[model samples]
Target: MITGGSSGIGLSVAHDVARRGASVTLVARNVSRLEKAQQEVELTMSKLSMDGKVQFFSSDISGSVKNISEMVKNAEASLGPVYMLINCAGFARAQKFEDLSPDLMKQMLDINFTGPMVLTQEVVRGMKVQQEGGVVVFVSSQAGLLGLYGFSAYSASKAAIVRAAEALHMELKPHNISVTVCYPPDTDTPGFVEENQTKPIETKLISEAAGLFKPEEVAKKLVDDSLCGAWSSTVGLEGFMLTTLCAGMGPITDAASFMAQVFLSGLFRSVSAFYLWSFTRIVEREHKKRLENKKSE
Candidate 1:
């Protein structure tokens, strides 16, 4: 079961899962898009000649727990027990701290962090009862690892997911349930496009350093890492460096990752300092330019 499965990374994950011969239940708020995504997944199933069923439930992830629980119950009834629960339904709105509204902050917390956290609670209850352990994935962001300019609210929400997933990884380890949190870089998605519109110049410059990725690429890595029971899922060289550098007290899913984090910590710190310096320069330059324009006015 994938939330936000109607479009973007969520939809891409649905296609990948469908091709793997797994029955899928897509959850999203847009009924029309959900219908289209269902058709797309069914098409993938047909091409693979898989007998897996495809269904969709249109609902908001930020809605009440009662409604979310019902959504899960109905999904399982249609597609059997959920072996994997991927929380991919989230959005971002980049704005400077002073420009943000109280409502926007609450919305960010509700949709990005609380919604997935609540849904995970419902799904894990059944997962623990079933003999087959489950995989729970949270799709966080690169900004979650390091705060970025113009992403005050957005970064805070995504960062919360990372911390929660870390605790969950420990608790669910004994239950044979692996929780993976994926920190995807700027991906080419509808949400990313919308987010860019509100981004400050400094934020754009700093974020561009990480480079953009495709939804399919991010989805593939996310699904692969979750299935492998890897605690941290990330893409690109920058992503590897960030995850490794910020992997303090995180679950050591593999010996290799642990070794890399241990050995490369110093080198990554040196690199991060350079990156931080450049980001500060960008912010100062932008501020100066705005001030000059105001003087001219």
Candidate 2:
């Protein structure tokens, strides 16, 4: 089951898993997009000559608990118990701390953090009972690792997912359940385009340092890492550095990740200091420009 599976990285993940002959259910709020995504998955399955089912569920993950529970029940009824639950149904709204409204903050927490938590709770109950266990993937962002300008609320929400997934990883390890948190860099998605429109100058410049990635690339990496039960799924050199630097007592799923984090912490710390300095300089320059414009006005 892939939430936010209507489009973007989520849809691409649906395609990736479908290629592996996994029965998939695309979950999102848009019925039309879900229909289209379902058709796409079906096409993928057809090409591979796989017999697994492709389904879609139109429901808001951030809505009432009862509704979300029912949606899970219906989904599982259609496609059997969810073996993998990818919590990808989230959005980003770039706004400065001062510009963030109360409603906007609440909405970010609701959709990005609480929604995934609630859905995972519902699905995890059944996953515990299944003998084969399961896998859970949470799609967080690089912003979650390091808070940046114009992402005050968005970073908080995504960070919450990271911490929550850590706690969950400990709890579910005994049950043979694996929890993976995917920290994707800026991917070329519809959501990314929308988010860029409202980004502050500092945010835009600081984020551009990471470079953009294709959704298919991100999705493939996410799927591969989750299937391998890797604790943190990311892409590129910078992603590796961030994940290693920010991995604070997270589940040590592999010896290689542990070794890298142990040996590279100091080096990454030095590198991150430089990045932080650059980001601060950008923010300072932008603030100076704004003050100059205000004085002229």
Candidate 3:
């Protein structure tokens, strides 16, 4: 089961996993978009000649706990017990802290944080009852690791996901359930396009250094990591360094990864300080330019 499975990373994951013969239930809000995504998934399955069932549920995941619960129940009933639940239905509205509206903040928390939490609760209940164990993947962001100038609300919401997944990892391990949280850098998606419209100059400049990734690339890595029961999934060198630096009490199931984290974390931290300084300079320069323009006016 994948939330936000109608597009972006979620939809790509659906295609990759389905190609690997996993039945998928895509949960999204727009019926038309869901239908379109379902068709795309079906086409992929056909091309791969994989016998995988693809279904979709059109419902607002952040709206009601009861409704989401019913939706999950229905999905499992139709698609069989969900072996994996990927929380990928989220959006970002980048703006400066002073410019962020109250409603927008609430919306971010509701959609990015609360929605996934609620859906995971509902699905995990079934996972526990079945006693078969399962995988829960949370699609967090790079901002979740390090807060950025224009992403106050978004970073807060995504940061919640990282901590929640960390706690869930410990709790679910006894039940044979594994939780993997992915920290993906900016990806080429509809959400990224929308986010860029209001993204602060500092935020944009800082993130650009990390580079953008394709949804398919991120999805493939996420799926493979989750299947391997990795505690954290990251893409590229930047992502790996950030994950290691910010790991902080999070589960480290792989010895080699742990060793890398311990050895490279300090070096990365020193390198990150330079990036932090550069971002601070950008913010200050932008602010000064705005002030000078106001004075001229």
Model 1's alpha-carbon lDDT is 0.93
Considering only N, C-alpha and C atoms within 3 Å, which residue pairs clash in candidate 3? none
- lDDT tens string, model 3, 60-163? 87898899989988998888888899999999998889999999999999999999999999989899997579999999999899888989899999999989
Model 2 TM: 0.98
How do the predictions measure up, each by TM-score? 0.99, 0.98, 0.98
Question: Between the candidate structures 2 and 3, which one is better when assessed by lDDT?
Answer: 2
Assess each prediction's global lDDT (C-alpha) against the native: 0.93, 0.93, 0.91
Residue lDDT tens for model 2, 1-297: 999999999999999999999999889988999998999899999999999999888999999999999998998888899999999989999988999999999999999999999999999998987556999999999989978889989999999999999999999999989999999999999999999899887888998998999999999999999999999999989999999999988999899999999999999999989999989999899899999999999
Q: In candidate 1, how many clashes are counted?
A: 0
Candidate 1, residue 66: the lDDT equals 98
The local lDDT score (0 to 100) that residue 292 gets in candidate 1 is 100
Candidate 3 Cα outliers beyond 4 Å, as residue runs: none
Winner on TM-score (1 vs 3):
1
Local accuracy of candidate 1 as per-residue lDDT tens digits, 1-297: 999999999999999988898999999999999999999999999988999999999989899999999998988887778899999999998888999999999999999999999999999999998656999999999899988888889889999999999899999999999999999999999989988898888999999998999999999999999999999898999999999999999999999999999999999999999999999999999999999999999
